[model samples]
Target: MPPRWPRTPDRNDPAFRRLEDFINFALHAAIYLAVNSGLWFFQLLNHPWDNLSIVSGVWLLGLVSHGCYVFILADYRRIEAAAQGNWQQELATELEEDATVTPDEAPSSPEQP
Candidate 1:
């Protein structure tokens, strides 16, 4: 029988949760890289490394502050739902497809009269 509830995300689906983690990581990395580059430019201009090092600290803090953990959790939750074979989720997917199904390709129902 089809599942009665929506499918939960499968945290095991490496593609799902992992992707979110990757995104979070990339975001943090980008922020860090930008800061580092700016600091490097300043150092080149004779600014002291002492002040520039602060950017690294801020970058580290931003990784946690940006809620990377939350995104990872959310991704895992989605994977769990999918693993549960949730019919509600299946139905929703089918409905979405139906909206796109061409009229000519759609099956007809009986007792139209």
Candidate 2:
């Protein structure tokens, strides 16, 4: 079964972004394996094709690059920290706005009979 997120999937979510990147890389690798294996099998059976190595080599490079980005280069911790900072700033701003409310703007309580 495919994985499910606890909440709605948003690009801003650091964990979601990291998982999505890994899923994409996994899909890419699976496709590369399936297609390249087929190509190599056929080539070996019917004599080697000149361009087959070139195609596989280029595709391998792309797969490696994707893996590198997903596993090594992605900064999920930094993203999460930035998101937390933004949330705290928003909370502080809301508290500040609430503190500035004048008596006329504030909600009134019901009068006792």
Highest lDDT scorer: 2
**Candidate 1 wrongly placed segments (more than 4 Å):** 1-14, 48-50, 61-113
Per-residue lDDT for 1-113 in model 1, tens only? 95342345554664556655666778777877887888788898986777566767776787766665655444454455566767478668768988986568566667755
Candidate 2 weakest ten by summed lDDT: 81-90
Models, CA RMSD each:
13.3, 16.1
Q: Per-residue lDDT of 1-113 in model 2, one digit per residue for the tens?
A: 96678998988789899988998999999999999999999998987789999999999999999999999998786677566777666667768998986668667789989
TM-score of 2: 0.68
Residue ranges of candidate 2 with Cα displaced over 4 Å: 85-113
State the displacement of the C-alpha of residue 95, model 1, in Å, after optimal TM-score superposition: 37
What does candidate 1 score on TM?
Answer: 0.39
